[model samples]
Target: MKFFDVFLKQFRLQWRQYLVASLASYGSLCTGMSMGWTSPVLPQLRGPNSPLPEQPTLQQESWIGSLLVLGGLIGPFITVPLSKHVGRRWLIMGSNVPLLLGWLLAGVTTNLPTLYVARLAWGCATAMQFATVPIYIGEIAEDKIRGALSAFFLLFINIGFLLAYAIGPFTSYWGLTACGGIISLLYLPFSWYLPETPFFLVFKGRLEEASSVLQQLRGKTKDEVQPELDSLQAMIAREYEEEPKISDLWASRGSVKALGICVFLAMLLQLSGIDVLLFYMEELLAKVGTKISPSDGTIIMGVVQVATSCVTPMVVDRLGRKLLMWTTSLGLTIFLTLIGVYALLDNYYKYDVTSVTFLPLLCLIVYMILFTLGVGPVPWILVAEMFPLKTKCLASGICSFMCWLAGFIWTRFFRDVAASYGIYTAFWILAVCCGIGFIFSVALLPETKGKTFDEIQDLLNNRTKQGNPGA
Candidate 1:
């Protein structure tokens, strides 16, 4: 069959799975993007022209930023256990309630305390979606399409970033918050249509429900469903039989190695300074003596984000995760370093407008393109695939917590860092972080492309055996 014919047939047969995956993915993306929107506004929200109090200094802003990070740290601890007890669908759907209310409250609040509460609430809702959605997608997708389907999380996140970046600067805070409320509305209809993950259903011992979802997802008849269901049941049974405890995560050499890899990868992605760039684009642009208005700069940033996001999925599987990440990180490091040097030259050496204006913009564009292609998508993909089934939730939860904590650190500090150290110096620090990321990717990270979950688990187990020499 032609590719489109196959796609249409699959959609027709598995509309429910598609709908569920799309909705889950969309909700996750919306929450992530909502947070991205506020990055640029933090300074403005606390500036002298702002309506809020001035008693809290930049140091206080950092403290408030930590609250957002603290929310991320707390969420997975709360939600992951709940997901095992309840179900992914409801947990995911329910998260929207706080996200919607948080943004609405934030938009209307004048008090700093109320705004912090809203941010904390928003962070909790975002963490819930983050923890559940990938697991949902992993459990629902067939082995053949799992990687491609998983990429949807990153793709939609970029879409969210693009939307927020485009809309944020053009409108008032209230209008932007309203946009978040509208996006939150999408979660309701999604909850109505989304199916419980087949893995979760199977885990619950609902064989018939699992079988039905399998048939729907594969566009298969009852005959075709049995083999897949049987395979899944066997896999789940084996996993539960040898379930690894949280203690096993640090005690086992292989598990510890995998955990370290995930944490490092996630931290590298955050500390690479992409969040700071996205969040502080207006300020960064102004720092370089560029005349572009905040609204126009944001629109430009949005366009670059969307344009580069399209490149990752097409080449992710083909390029292999390690190569893509290393190449992108190296490229980003080079471009960022050059941008910093140029900015320094602009400040110190008095370059002409032509050289100063277009060069830095070109470098920034290159940095964005490199980021989307490699670092943006690879960390999530790797984290999702790296862990064994038993450790998946706990490991992912820890990794995501670290990721958010890193985000909180960068968002909280970048403004003050820029103010104190200069934008050029800040970019230099980020360039160094990107360089370190490249080194780690080359030395430590393993290739996971085209590997099934079973194969990955076996590999890790074998490595554990080799390392222990006894077990």
Candidate 2:
């Protein structure tokens, strides 16, 4: 087929999927702003004309950044149970409550307690969005485009980060919070219109509803959608033959393997130090003595981040997952090492490195670019891709929880580490982590691009191991 003819055909078939996925992904966007909020706002909170009752101490600022992730710890527990009952669509809509409240409160609050509560609320919503959005997108999208739709979860988030980076530096504290709250509020009304995932509907015994949703998602007539609906019914029937338990997550060797890979990838994502770079973008740039102002530096990096994130959905399927993972991880390792060496020579050795003063910012911009490509999006895509529908929510929740837990610990102690050792120590540690990630990508990660879920399960189970066939 001609390229445009193929593009038009796919768009006609998948537009609804894209629409709902984009709507659901707004939550990820809001969560991104929440994550990026600290980068610009925290410095202002510590400045002379602080917005709070008093300027926040270093400890309090750390709490502000880390508490969002700490709140993420409770997300999976709530989403896992509620997702089965209320369904993924409503869980996504309901998450807006916390996000809206969090932004509203953060905008007006004067006291530390109230501010921390706002951050925590953002965390809870972040967890919920992470848990439901990917799975919903996974179930609704055709296998061919599933990787791209799933990657949208991270793409929207980077867009939000860019929004925060661009907006926060220009606006008042309340103004920034107001924009976030407005986005959260807007997301709720449209969410009510999104179709529930057919997987969830079928699992809930709403077969007719499941078929209708599948038809809508596929942009197909009832007759055309029947075969796919039948497939979903059979898969759900087989998977849910017995009531699914938390134990079902490991019922098969494949399921167990999927969970292990997901959890490890989740941990690797956070430990690679994206959070420190995000939550402390301004500070990190300032410390590195970049000629560009810190806020300007963050905006520059944010622009690169969003731009690079846009490329992933286009290339992910064509290039495949493991290759992207390996490529991005290796790039991250090299750039992170460069950043560390720059910091060490400039900060510790007091070397005259003015000739290469631009290297740190250059490394960071490239780091964010490389990170947005694979390390940032692929793990979450895997979370949605690798699990059976029966245990998807629980498995995804565990992965999301692990991701945020690592983020909480890593971001919380980052300043302490930088203070006690040196800033170079922080980047070197992350570089080492990314190097390990490169090894894991080569050795442990499997290619899931364009595979059906059953086929993925079979691969995980080693049912077909010739040349790792799909790999």
Candidate 3:
């Protein structure tokens, strides 16, 4: 059978579960919508068609960008605590209120202070998303399709981005803000139709509700779900066996192991210099003496990014996570090395280097495609998959917190690091980090392609029992 035909047949068996996916993916869409608006709207604010009487000064623009990060630093404080007590479903739905308000705030006011507040609100919405959605998907999806489903978080993120880039350039100021309002409004009913994850219900000791939801999710009769339900109960029982004592840094040997992987993946995602490529593509291209316009270079990179995202959900289950991550990290190392070498020759060695200008652009294009294939989506999936139920709430919170913290520090210091050390030195640093990350991934990253949540947790606990065959 053809691929779409086969996929549709599978969809028939599991379409409701995918409605769950659709609900989860709206967070990603909201996130991408927020991200996409900034690029187009910022220019509109400053252009001859200024929304305000006076355009924002350069410092104001810079703070507007950084304020989101500042609010992002704080947003998880709300999500981590509230999500643990209130459950995943509402926090996701609650995140949208901010998204709607933030955009509406933008639509109504051109005031910088109000814009700053809206940007902060949007940042919180983004954090709520990164914190909640993957865990929900991990809890609900069957092991057979977990990687692909978790990947929807990222696929929709880029789709939001592409939609913003494609549509925002042409739309009016009010229309741009309306876009976010529309997505937020649509998410309400779609999210309502989805079930709360069985794990959450079980964790709360609502066993009957848990079983009912699991029956709906698994599309099996109660007798068929008994073994799976038992596994979930056992996992939950063990997790709450005693009130969990908070370790210093919440460190259990098992959690430490899981955290080490989260840290490495987070580091790989940020330190691969993906941010440098995205935010400063044009500037870097100029430094390399490329004839390509910054806009064209950015457009090319964006196209390659969206194109590569499509490749993962199809192949991740087939090829597995470890191979793709290792390959992409290694690829990043190679391309970054080439770009760094070219920069080295140009700046310090005084090689005119005009002839090889295309090399850096080529390296960036290939580097972005490779980056999207693995580093972009896999980390979030691993974060969702690797934790035990006992620690899933706190562990995911800390893990995502560190991610935002890393992003803030990296973006803040990257320019200083470049200015003080020179751009070639910066690329070389990112290249060295990628080279080291390749070794780290090879040594420690878990292969989670087909494993159940219990199996992955067992691996974390260093126990050696076979998982439920049904899982």
Candidate 4:
């Protein structure tokens, strides 16, 4: 009863902030799933029976997919700075416009060129939303509940993934477009209810506005809000006392290492073969001899993703980021290695083929669970927490760009690798990458558990003294 009361109290106090964060977070999920959900349908879309134009060759389809990923690579570098200048609310709201437009075009277009253009636009908008939502969530949440709230972002992302996976298998192009439109409509009313980031408002010298926003967010009266407001002002004043310049990101050794750490982590997460499974789950399952319908595969994968993501918010703060990442990497490496072995046995060795094939499917499910728990949630949490205020926006942009670049590389090449070297060999390569990631986490990653933003800044700056350059 006491626990329930506290839960209710927190909800009542933070409901508005929660609603905004949830919606913005959902936008990111919708965007990622919008692209990912379409992957399963691509072969059909390009088949002779497709309602659109004549089908392209597999190679041409691959090239078009690469273009969409390239758009994601370029978007963050453009949007992050814009958000810093224009404010989070406007930038987030603006991102949805292109997404909506892209889906509209995709659903109606009869030509492949127009479809490619629509996907490129959708990628850009999705990347923008992904890069900004965390910054907004981190800025608005109270320190006590920040971790939980931030984890909610991952929860929504998994929810979107699940929805896409389930819906994409059964829905036609028109149905997918309608779903995208619904997500867009939700964005307008949801974003309107959001209070501006107090940090951004205060930075603009709108103290009164900042105070009111902060009070409403905390569900407190002015008297209760004053202490937090005063603390925020002092923190901002100190941050600006040195007049941080954009160049500081590359100039200072600490900042440089901080940027490197974020970029490396982002790259590691993508190369872990998680997205390969996400974007090509149905195809991947078929390769391993699990010949379930695409719709069924998608539903299974989605449920696993959501279940694991739900577990993350509970364990993340308690177990700490470094441990979670290390554990995830280790688990991924083992599962992937086992998957590779099973593939080889089933396809080449042909010894006990039935066992070999079925075992790999089970391992793949395990891999998904491990991924959701560690890699999926931990990387985003680290990216959100690792940077100091002065360089956060710039650093996040760079990191997100690197992430998309890695995604582009993986998506572009995974198909060729599977075609030439075989699925088993590809899984082997991912296993090796996961092994390398585990080493990196242990040697380079810092434990940011229980630290405030300022303390994390100090820790990041004191890297050399700690004898860890990556920290």
Clash count per candidate? 0, 0, 0, 0
**Tens digit of lDDT per residue, candidate 3, span 221-287?**
8888888889888878877787654462246666788877886787667778765455445456777
Candidate lDDT scores, in order, read 0.74, 0.87, 0.75, 0.76
In order of appearance, the predictions have TM-scores of 0.89, 0.97, 0.87, 0.92
Number of the top-ranking candidate, with TM-score as the measure: 2
Ranking by TM-score: 2, 4, 1, 3
Local distance difference test, candidate 4:
0.76
Predicted candidate 2 versus true structure: per-residue lDDT over 1-471, tens digit per residue: 475477667777678888888888978988999999999899788767566879888899999999999989878988988887898888998888888889988987988999999999999999999888988888888999988888888889998888999998998787788898888787877788888888888878888998888888877889998999889889988988888788888888989889988998899899999989998999999887677899999999989988887777777776788888888999999998988899889989999999998999999988988888889888989998899877888899899999999999999999999989999898889999999999988988888888888888888999965243134
Q: Model 4, stretches more than 4 Å misplaced?
A: 1-13, 46-48, 251-253, 463-471
Superposed by TM-score, candidate 3 places the C-alpha of residue 273 at a distance from the truth, in angstroms, of 3.2
RMSD of 4: 3.0
Query: Which candidate model has the greater lDDT, 1 or 2?
Result: 2
Please give the range of 10 consecutive residues that has the lowest summed lDDT in model 1.
Answer: 462-471
Q: When superposed on Cα atoms, how far off is each prediction in RMSD? A: 4.4, 1.7, 3.7, 3.0
- Tens digit of lDDT per residue, candidate 1, span 128-176? 7677777778788765456556667766777877777777766666667
lDDT of 4 by residue, 1-471 (tens): 675577668778678777767876767676766666555567567666565767777676666566666778767866766865788888888877777777787777887878778778877886786677788888898765666667777777778778777777677766766786776668677767667899888878889999899877877888888888888889888877785677878866557767877788888878998767777777777776554665676678788878887766656665777887888899999999988887777776766766444566678778878877777777677677877676777778888888889988987798799889888999999999999989988888777776778767667777323322223
lDDT of 3 at 383: 85
What's the CA error at residue 400 for candidate 4, in Å?
A: 0.6
Clashing pairs in 1: none
- Give me the displacement of residue 80 in model 3, in angstroms: 1.8
Better of 1 and 3 by lDDT: 3
